[model samples]
Target: MNPAREAMINGWKSPRKGDRGRERERDITAPRHDSSSRISKPARQQPPAKSTASNAVGKYLTQDQQSEQFVADEDKFVLKQAKKKADIRVREQRAKPIDYLAFSLRFIDTDRDVFDDHEGDVEVDIPAPETVLESLNHAQLQELHEDLTSYQTLESNARNKEFWSALLVLCADRRQKLKPQGPEGRALASVASDVDNILSPKSLEQLEALEKQIRTKLQSNEPIDTDYWEELLKSLLMYKAKAKLRKVCEAIKAAKVELLRLVDPEKAEELEESDGLPANSHNFAPSPAKPATRPVASSSDAQSSAAPPPGTARFSSTGNEDFSQATKALYDREVARGVGEGEEIFAAEEAVPSATKPLWADKYRPRKPRYFNRVQMGYEWNKYNQTHYDHDNPPPKVVQGYRFNIFYPDLIDKTKAPTFKIIREHGRRRGESFAPAGKEDTCLIRFVAGPPYEDIAFRIVDREWDYSAKKERGFKSSFDKGILQLHFQFKKIYYRK
Candidate 1:
């Protein structure tokens, strides 16, 4: 055996029983040719070596000796020139701005038959330098991952001669060079304990054959098979997808924890956990163990937990509660616990901003006002006390001069449960005047119609206290500016003319 082969043999015994048989088969099939046969014969000549003392004497060789040395040097020079030319060609090929067709074929076609199809108007736009470098780095990482995975699988199935032989040869030829870098390299270091168990002469032989074939193809300018490359690309994509899913689940768990923290700071403090999403599974260390579930609260406990202290603002069970107030209170509770601004909380690094340019007013960019007021009303003029004699305190019916200019018609219909509040406060008047406590009915409209569609449907509740009990009020109407007005009050409505 050669020195390299002997060293490999000394490292470990064969991992497969069929190693000898495969070796014999490979040797029998290997190509053999006469070594003495030459395609082109050149005239044999000997050249004199220049003596060290000849430098002091200036020149020592005669014309005949010089010609012989030139002939010998010419052969060496041609060989060196050919090698230099090959090197230059490789560099030029690599420097040629990315060949889109070739790149597409690298992923799409294994035999690379599509390389010839690159002559069309298919020009690959040169990406920004950073983008190109990033992609190249990713490709290198992917290549390392694939090689390591293959090596690992082969090592595991060492009992199978086909795998053992292939792996052994790969390990022998590639050894230090095949070792991965980055995250994959770290993983490889961890799992490379059974290298001795997987190496054998047969495996080495198989790897050698494959390596030779690849080198031959590259030298001959032949393309690799499409099916092989397609399967490889698919495997890479699947790995990436699985890693992405894992990351997404980890992020969701982290977001849930943050939300829980915002809801109850004391509970968040009790938990005392880290507050960030997991690192990407593709390149990071394995994930930590799942967090434990929080203790569940009993119904009574939850009720006690939600109840406010005595003397604070309280909603009576009998009184009609405002839905908007309830919604706002719930939202505020969430925000206080840990909820961040929506866009900042969810935005990811990889997302690219949209390129579509907007109008000058909106450029760079300007935002429209989100709040506005339509009408003003006096607080005291809007309030009236409910009489004990009346069964229900009816709302005032408005006499609108227009029908089409309604507000929130779709959301404020008869089906809606509207709540009205009467604010009571005492205000100081000018000198010599005493301010009396006054109340105003400000109806809270929960459902509002969006812009461009103008219509407001309102509920005229007869019994504010008995809101759950429905009463059908008769129609009342009034005519003004060619529009008829309808009013309903305390189970009675009038049609005005």
Candidate 2:
């Protein structure tokens, strides 16, 4: 270290600058020949072999298997996400509506306890008549009808009666408008409304007496508007049907209450004591000794206590052969067939009076069968409409077709099917239009079925039906499985340039 520092001092004092510069250049240009001075580089690692096994397996999978695999994978992912969210919610102490309901129900002693406090009180707030009538659109009115019918079956009380009557009055007013009648018809309608209100509270026997009187009037050769009398008879029958249904529902409710009472320990003990069983009977009772016979007695008691099947009891309560399985089936079918989305009800009538009674009227009472019909509406892109409207701004929808579904489950003659006839007013023939400008001609399409089911009719636009067998045209007229379905579309008129 001392010699190197002396040499570096001598070099710094030397005046030969050219020789020192040439030596530094030579040192930088020279290569390192020593083994230790050479640095080693790491070997290039080959990339891991690309996996073709997954691709090969995927290539062999069928369409259905692939779909199933995709669904399973999606389900797994959804389950994972749901579980994670549930854990987070649990940690946050968030409760769902059902959880709250379950917690509240834990304190309740019995089912009856939930409603005992609010007995004889209306649970829901009913809107005013005007408000309801104005607010309810076509679909809402249909829903209201369904709800009221259900309420009538479950709870046929004074409150429900008031609601039903109000609906009836509304319906009557609508009917009068649809079927414009003379002065005599108007007078009869007012009388009918008053009679309906009076008959609302009448017992089954009283209603039966009134029905007989009306029928007698119809059967007699008296000067009377037959249509009004027949309508009255039909209404009477409907009231009778409702009364019978109510009685059955009340009986069922009572049975359920009795069963609940028996289930209660205290009530059971009270009942046993009331039935002349001694308090200390258990100590001396021979019932335990003959356990084999107890099952037989219990079985018999169960059979006796069981309520009759509804289908069998349906028409039996009326004590008449008039209301058959067909009637009940039709009623149920109509109830189940609610208004379709985007479809409008053009005209719906429960019963249309028949001019003449069938020959088998005595054997089976002639009554108008129930029907639920619909009118399909859609934009008709004719020359006028196409010129004025586009997809973004559509034209007004007109009645494109009619769908008539009538039920007659228990037709007397199964071999013979129902038929329909078009009845024109003012002696107007087919293709003849006596209607005012901008109005279309209309006619009654009366559907005639076998005995016990009277003729029902509906007014429809007088136009040629599209009888094409194509699905788009939707022309169908057939009676199958107790339903008479007549679906047809109007023939579209095209204007050529």
Candidate 3:
């Protein structure tokens, strides 16, 4: 080999000055893991300490005798991979929840509260109850509510043992951490009671750990002792107590004297009274005691009370009257019930009652007049004297218009009613001065309306009277404030071109 060639090769392979400095620094600081560091600096070795769980927990050993107290490269690699798998879960979470601080580029979140995924649409901003018995820090109160809500929503099923156990732990934590004798405690206790419904003796399958324990004991050949029997008895008693406690807590949580009272005072009392009774009682708390009947005016009303007609069931024989919602709802329910009872009795009887002495409802039945009756439709229109007219013509004056249109909205299969607006000038006005033609009419007398009221009955009597009615009256009142001087009963509508 040539000396020059050998020198060139060595120059390329030799460490650079900067690399040599780094190598020297590493050598000086790097830890030593030789056999001397692991055992003692002796050739002979005694038998190693027996391997045990967690390095023989509770056994103290001097530092001089302890094995190399440092992690191995193989163990470090294993731990790194295990932690990577654990962090993958936190990184994939949509809510970004964390047991400890973490960060991830792929972390996803949502528009709603994290817990909303469990309980659909939680109602936020609910005003706190006024009867709080203990003062709690903001964090404590927040956590208290969250745990209560979680426990309340957790379903106890065979497949949800983990959820039930987690909920039980949360409940126990809240019960212990919160003021045990205060309002917050009572509120939490009520929420916790809901668990009894899910985890009572009837749903024992939800407690997998306890069930597994029992199974293991039953499978064991070892003799059972009195302590085991006592344990089982205690569990049975607890189940019974919880079963009864659930109903009481549910009632208190729903009653006006407790939960509902904070939300609504008017209905609180009514609901609280109902709470004491069984939930299945449909007729619980009889409809609040009925009030005394008013004096009846005529026999038209079929009311059985001492009060006459119009006392409750119907209006006086002649004039118009309306029943209030409360009054009508109660009266209708009672009447319907009574009618049903009468039918049952009649069906069971051997003979029918004569027409002269029919059931009370049939004997004094009230009649609801139709909106448009077929009578007095041919009343003679005397526009000359609006005030002087026969009683047969309900209105003394009416507005006449040929161009008016009536509209009906929401009709099936069409966007518009079977009607159209038409306008024609019968007489021209000079500079807004009216020039009455042979026939006088108005365009303002028309009205457009939505469904259920398109066919409003109207009569053409006098346009002047109709205009005056609009200015002087309300549609709901009486006082002869009629828009027309004459009214026609609904018989047949006419079409003219």
- The clash count for each model shown is 29, 0, 8
TM-score, one value per model:
0.17, 0.37, 0.16
- Whole-model lDDT per candidate: 0.29, 0.54, 0.31
Residue 45 C-alpha lDDT in model 1: 80
**Candidate 1 lDDT, 138-222, residue by residue in tens:** 3333443454344334232222223223323333323334445687456544634443233222243444454455455545745
Query: What TM value does model 2 have?
Result: 0.37
Order the candidates by TM-score, highest first.
2, 1, 3
What does candidate 2's lDDT look like per residue over 1-497, in tens digits? 33334447755333255666554444432453555565778989998865798766656887889898797676545433332332222221222211111221112213222322222111111122323333334543454455444333333245434435545445434444445589876877678777688778889899999998988898999999898778777667667755654553343334334543544655444543442211221111113233221221122111111232333232111112223455545644453444455565444442344477678988976655555578888888998889999999999888878988888877879889999988887889998999999678888898999876778788788899999998867699999877888999999888889
Candidate 3 residues lying further than 4 Å off, grouped into runs, are 1-216, 225-241, 244-497
Q: Which residue window of length 10 is worst by lDDT in model 3?
A: 341-350
Between the candidate structures 1 and 2, which one is better when assessed by TM-score?
2
Model 3 lDDT tens row, 126-195 = 1111111022333434544563344234322222223223333433333455534687446545645554
lDDT score of model 2? 0.54
In candidate 2, list every pair of residues with a backbone clash: none
Model 1 CA deviation exceeding 4 Å by range: 1-225, 264-439, 443-497
Q: Which of the numbered candidates is closest to the native, going by highest TM-score? A: 2
lDDT, candidate 3, at 23 = 47
Could you tell me the C-alpha RMSD of candidate 3 in Å?
A: 30.1
